[model samples]
Every structure is written in structure tokens, then in C-alpha cells.
Target: MRRDEFRKAFFDASDRVHTYAVWMIRNREDARDIAQEAFLRLWQRCETVATQSARAWLLRTVHRLCVDRIRQRTRRQEVSLSMLPIDSFVDADATTDWSPDGDLRGDVIRAVVALSPEDRAVVVLREVMGMSYGDMGEVLAQPVSTVKVRLHRARKRLRCRLEPLCEKRSVR
Candidate 1:
């Protein structure tokens, strides 16, 4: 990609790429680092990655980096809720009630965090990022059908985990 094209792509996709990284890694600093690294990689491969597909390329790169980071966290057994601020779980565009009495946000975050990295990625890409199945499949390197199945399974798992909490909150 040319300099001008690269600049345009950066302007257009930086927020989305950073958001995906944040949701995947659940650490702002780490997410920033991952986003930087992904953009750097894109720059390095500018000759190879077409400008039109830059966002998808960045997403795919970000996904791979997140998976590696998650694996490292797993091996070290160092994952912690303290590392992920509760505020990061809030969706700016979401219409869900944020009031204290109706807030199951913390429970939702916990449930999402408990998901395996692959499942979490599927959830973040589909539900949070609002990517279509074909786009998600490209990012995940899976078939579209597989992406749909994974998303369905992830949502079901989240529902199962959060249903009790929702019920409890409703009873009060």
C-alpha cells in the first residue's frame, strides 16, 4: 500500500482494530501493544497486503496475536480480573440498562472471561464487534459455517453461565 492509502486505512480501522484487541485481551495496555504490533506488521507487509483488505488483514493479525498472548497467560496461570477494568466491558453503543439495580455487567464480564479464548473471540467478533460470519471466518481462518456454529455455541455457553445470575437479579 502507498503512504496515502496506508494513512487512510489507519484512520478508518484503528479504532476497530484496537477495540477488537481490547475485547480479546481484556487489558488496555496489552491491547494497545497488540494493536501497535499488528499495524506495524501491516506496514511491513504493505507490499503484499492490499489496501482494500487492510482491515480484515489487521483483524486476522490481531486475532493471532491475541491467541498467542492468551496461550502465554494460560501457561503462566496469571490471568486475573484485576487486570481487566469493569468499564472496558461496557459497550458504548449498547442500549442495555446501566443502572445499579439492573446491572449484570459484572456477571456478564465474568462469564465472557471464563470462556475459552477461541469461544471468546467468536463472541467478541460476532456480538460485540458486529462482524458478519464471512468476515469473522476470514479473521478466524474458519469456514463461514464453522464461524456460525462457533458463535451459536459461544452464545449458548454465555447464556447458560449468566442465566442464574440474571434470574437472581430479577428475584430481588
Candidate 2:
């Protein structure tokens, strides 16, 4: 990409790239790193990257980078709340049980974090980022059908995971 084109792409995509990274990684600092690295890679591969497709390309690169960092976090024993076993995270310290009386947003966030990273990625990309399935497929390197299926499954899992909490609220 020419410098001018690259500049335009950067200006248009920097916030989106960072938002996607933050959702994937759940750490602003790390998200910034991923955004920077992805942009750097884009710059290095500018000759091959099409300016018209730069946003999708940047998002895909950031996703892969986030996955790699997650792997490293596992090795270093700093796995995210999202990677924790649902049961383990829910029952940590055994100090309390989840109830509607507790903060609903916190409970929802905890449930979301307990999902598999892949599921979380689809959810964030499609739902949080409001990307169409085709766009999500491009960024995630999945076929459109696969993206649809994964998103459906993730929603089902989240609904099932949160059902009890919802039930508690309704009962009250």
C-alpha cells in the first residue's frame, strides 16, 4: 500500500482494531500491543495488502495475535478469566453463590468470560462488533457457514449458562 493509502487505512481502522483487540484480550495494554503489532505487520506486508480490504486484514491479524498471546499466558499461569473453567470461576473461593441479588452485569460478564476463547471471539466479533457473518468469516478465516454455526452455538451456550441466573430473577 502507498503511504497515503496506509495512512488512511490506519486512521479509519485504528479504533476498530483496538476495540476488537480489547474484546479478545480483555486488557487495554495488551490490546494496544496487539493493535500495534498487527498494524506493523500490515505495514511490512503493505505491498501485498489491498487498501480496500485493509480493515478485514487488520482484524484477522489481530485475532491471530490475541490467540498467540493467550497461549503464552497459559504457559505463564496468567490465563484470563475467560479461559477458566466455568464451574471453577463461578465457585471460586466458595464464598457465595450467584444470585439475582448480586450484580447482574457482573454475573453476565463472568458467564461470558467462562466461555471457550473461540466462542468468545465469535460473540465479540459478530455481536459486540456488529459485523455481518460474511465480514466475521473473513476476519476469523472461517467459511460463512462455519461462522454462522459457531455464532449460533455460542449464543446457545451463553443462554444456557445464564438461564439459572435469569430464572432466579424471575422467581423473585
Candidate 3:
């Protein structure tokens, strides 16, 4: 494809790419950086990557970059980005339907943050990104059957973790 075509495609895909990166990495600045690099790589490999599979290629690139960033941070002993402060949702300027519920939403966010990276990524791709099993498999580099199993296990694990919290709220 030509430069103009590549730029258009990049712009078209950039928003979702950034969102996925943010969901996976949990830091706005880092997510932006990762998305930038992913797009750069996409440009670098544009001729190599098939036009029909560019979205999957872009997402897979972003995912790989996120994993690398996590590892680099780990080696440096930096706190995990996924471990955000509970007050992250306590904004007075924000409006959420769960605002009346106080800490329940925060608690759920915490539970999700506590999940393993792979589980978290699977959950985000399936639930947050609303990706199909085949699409998810393409991005995750797993078989469709493996993607289904992983997503199933991730959902079950999340449900198990969230159930007690829900029950407590219900009891109140």
C-alpha cells in the first residue's frame, strides 16, 4: 500500500489499538507509547503484513509490546501498572451509574487488576474489546480452541473472585 493508504489505515485502527493497549497496560502514558510503537512497527512492516490481517497484526504488536514493557518494569522493580490506587475511581468530576454504590465498583476493579496478566488480557480482549474467539486467537497467537478455553477459565476465575464481593454487597 502507499503512504497515504497506510496512514489512513493507521488512523482508522489507532483508537481501538490505544484502547486495547490502555486496558492491557493500565497506564495512559505507557499505553500511548506502546500504541505509538506498535503503529511504527506496523509501518515498518506494512509491506510484510497482509492487508487483510492488519488489525490483528497491530493488536498483536501492541500486546507484545505491553508484555515487554511489563517485563522491563519487573526487572527494574517498578510497581506493576495494573496495581493502581483504589482512589482511581474517586473522581468528583466523573459520572458513573455505580457512583451511588461507593466502593463496589472500585472493589471489582481491584479484583480484575489482581488477575494474572494472561488472564487479564484474555478478559479484556473478550469482554472489553468484544472480540470473537477466532479474532482473539489471531491476536493472542493461540488456537481458537485454546482461546475459548482460556477465556472460559478467565471468566470462571473472575466470577469466582467477584462472587464473594457481590454476596457481601447483597447481604448488606
Most TM-score-accurate candidate: 1
What is candidate 3's local distance difference test score?
A: 0.81
Instruction: Give candidate 3 regions above 4 Å deviation.
Output: 80-96, 100-105
* lDDT of residue 81 for candidate 1: 58
Worst 10 residues of 2 by lDDT: 82-91
Provide the clashing-pair count of each candidate structure.
0, 2, 0
Residue pairs with clashing backbones, model 2? 1-46, 82-113
**Model 1 lDDT at residue 89:** 65
Cα RMSD for predicted model 1: 2.2
RMSD per prediction, one decimal? 2.2, 6.9, 3.1
- lDDT string, candidate 1, 1-172, tens digits: 8756888899899999998898888888899999999999998899999888899999999999999998898899985554676656676577466643336777787788778888899998887788999999989999999988999999999999999999998997
Ranking by lDDT: 1, 2, 3
Worst 10 residues of 1 by lDDT: 94-103
Which residues of candidate 1, in runs, are more than 4 Å off? 91-96, 99-102
